[model samples]
Target: MGPPALYALLMLAVPLATIFAYTFWTQDGLTIDRTLTFSNYREAFNDPLYRQLMLRSVWIAGAVTLATVMTAFPIAYFVSFHVPQRRKALWIFLITIPFWTSYLIRVFLWKVILGYNGVLNTTLLGLGIIDEPLSFILYNANAVVITLAHAFAPFAILPIFVALEKIDRSLLEASRDLGETHLTTFLRVTLPLAMPGIVAAALIVFIPTIGDYVTPRLVGGPDGLMIANMIQTQYLRLNDAPMGATLAVLAMAIVAVISALVFLASRLTARIWA
Candidate 1:
């Protein structure tokens, strides 16, 4: 506890405290003024652009979380329940093959696949599926969601797989023996147990996706830009350290609130299942 606590204090708490302190100060020319002020927060809340970006970030992150979890669950279920025990590790290894490449490279590949004259449109054109290439898939919120969902799929799958693996086969068998259908057994005996993993996967995908500037910057175009993009602009381009810190703090607070809500919901669901 001593070493770990010290490590956290230095690595996590120190940086966060510094950022929090920065939010109260102002930047003038090249100098960071130590004068305490709440003007940064005021501007963050009052500005319509910042509000829109914040809302958009949350919406995109939520969509990415939902898509990733919904798709990953079935894959995880197949691997955990259907794959031969001896091959489970191999399947998991295959699932992580995407991580073997750099994340930036993966995002770039998705850009190519979804681009106007890219692989998907080319294939569609070759098959005579459409007269022209579709423009909606690559440079908008749809592209952001698609890219993030693919990128985070493995994170969602592994947790749900762990939860599914921990399910007692006897309980499922007993439920079946008592005349329950497979669907009923799954609903009553399996899903509640898997909720923890689902929650974990959701948080893992949502938190960072909200903060991701790269994917949005690369493929999100103008419409797909998020709060992180704004933060980067304020901090780097505008050289407004206080405003950037304020945005970062606000985003962190929003994520914290949402995470707490998810945890509470999990507890409530567990109690209901009990």
Candidate 2:
């Protein structure tokens, strides 16, 4: 391999190796020793709290992925097939403009909008829509899902749009010539061609959402907490490095397995289409 590629691999290898070693190693309250053990993993599995956190994380991430993809597909479709080529790039850029700012700021903006006395509540109260501010809108699992979905929407849109743009216009016309309805053409041609982009978008959103700590920590209540939040607590507040490392490793494993399943499913779908 080239020197830059070798150096990049070496850099990644060092930290990953350290994390793996740390997860297996034993630790006291403050210090970790290099003694290998499975006790940390056992603790993670045995703890009902961690299990719930992990399940919630996966659920939230899945929800975000589904929501973003469902919402993005239509916008991407319009941009790719209906909009003029000259305006397509501008439309896509406008869609992604929110991401130019920090992710934390964007999520926090949602918090402000959803807060009990925030914009929505103020407008509603001023217009006499409700007597009291809505507390359930923020600081919940739903809020986390919504906020993360908004944050990841652009990531989902750009890839799907690119995939749609890459498809040959002739193929779509040919499908129509064969007496296929628009819906049938979409199902048989457009969707299959867009699979790679859909997979890419899913990975971009789901993987990071699974490990996201910011949105959950800022807006999520106790029940909305994810595995990443717990992992952070273990490392910083609890000062249990081994347990924290264990949670990190578990999160990585979960992401890896889910990603692999997505890849396999996509391949299977492609094979069936072929």
Candidate 3:
């Protein structure tokens, strides 16, 4: 009754509690020791490999977030400002069409597009622009970033569009009335007003992309493997549930810190704009 008790209990509290307890347990061979200990957490921090992967995941997620927002903003602006009101629904519908397909399908499409003999390379090869198929685009952090940015594009666009749409037309007119150019009005008024949505989109895209296991697995070669992949290996393959839980909790903590920083930055931006 109080804020969907069953939902929170079954989904959040229960699973989190299990993971927390698991973090305090240790594994040896095929057996798990239920005795509570800090060894998992200890190993997580002391292990240099975990630290590097965590940092790399954060970096790739940041790249995806930046790329998604920058690309989404202009599309959102156009939908809010340039499109006829009657056709706005149509544009939004088209944006949502991709959602009807499977997420894996979209990712696989990117894989094919970026494959050695995939669409981009073949086209370039035919066009005589490149000497050989580009080798660096498909199986690295860049591919993971590109795949994630595309996967989360709609998430970024919707919030930003909502923010831009909510802006008062009168404010723009007033700016023009005071002799401000379009660019000046945009920088001075539009962008600042839309910071909340931009922030929302950034957090939304960044958090999940960092923990994204599949994108990195299919597209990311050994070098592009993220922390999530390691977590999965511990849980599924390595039979080390405690270590996996430790990595998971540590990842959540890092994401929490990053999210907090973003929230503080947004608050400061709001204060300055005010």
Candidate 4:
């Protein structure tokens, strides 16, 4: 095979081999063995807590994806269609500038902003909006969704903007010339053309958000714990390497299946437009 193909296979092999090895391997308390067994996978699927955690992880990630896309579409449209070409690159850069900072720092910044003595609560209390600090603001599902949305917003914006920029101006002109209203033109012409970018942004945000441990751990309380949190518990807290590997593999499979479904849906939508 070619060099690229060989590199790809090697990369794929490392993770697949590791997971396969771990799934069949066994452990006695702290000691792990190479003996083959299905108990790890069985436990992961059969345990009620694991199942709930996985479902919640998927749901939170989906919410983040939807929120990012909804917020990004307008900013992307403004940059691609309304901004002067010379300034568009600068504007896009500004959108992504937050990433230069440590991601952990950013999440902690939100904690400072939302905590009891944080800016938000202080300002609200000063204004007499509420008598006390809201406990739910700092460590919950809402915090996870908000912080992830802020972190991943630029990822959603740039792709959709690039896709919108690539759309042929002549096609849009033709629609207008044929007496189509601006809204109609956008619905029929602009939106369909931008679907690819929307799909790309969703995959970019959704996949990573599902496995994100840091945001949930830092900001998410007990209720916001995800599959990644469990994997971390298995590996670090419990010292169960086999179970940790099993959870990692399960999370990977869930991400892959969701990505495949999004890609397939995008293809179907493209076909219908065609």
Top of the candidates by TM-score: 1
Model 1 spans with C-alpha error above 4 angstroms: none
Q: Which parts of model 4 have CA positions greater than 4 angstroms off?
A: 1-12
Per-model TM-score, in order, reads 0.98, 0.95, 0.97, 0.94
Q: What lDDT tens digits, residue by residue, belong to model 4 across residues 1-274?
A: 6998889878998778887688788778768788888999999999999999999999999999999999999999999999999999899889989989999999999999988789999999999999998888878898999999999999999999999999999999999999999999998999999999999999999999999999999999998889999989988888888988888898989999999999999999888987
- Residue runs of model 3 more than 4 Å from their true location after superposition: none
Which residue pairs show backbone clashes in model 4? none
Estimate every model's Cα lDDT from 0 to 1: 0.96, 0.91, 0.94, 0.93
Cα lDDT of model 2 by residue, 37-91, tens digit: 8989998999999999999999999999999999999999899999998998799
Give the clash total for candidate 3: 0
Error of 1 at 110 (Å): 0.7
TM-score, model 3 to reference: 0.97
Write the residue-wise lDDT of candidate 3 on 1-274 in tens digits: 9769988999999999999889999997888899879988888999999999999999999999999999999999999999999999999999888899999999999999999999999999999999999989999988999899999999999999999999999999999999999999998899998998999999999999889999999999987899999999999999899999999999999999999999999999888877
Name the better of 1 and 3 by lDDT: 1
- Taking all chains together, the TM-score of candidate 4 against the true structure is 0.94
- The residue ranges of model 2 lying beyond 4 angstroms of the native Cα positions read 124-132
- Lowest summed lDDT over 10 consecutive residues: which window, candidate 2? 27-36
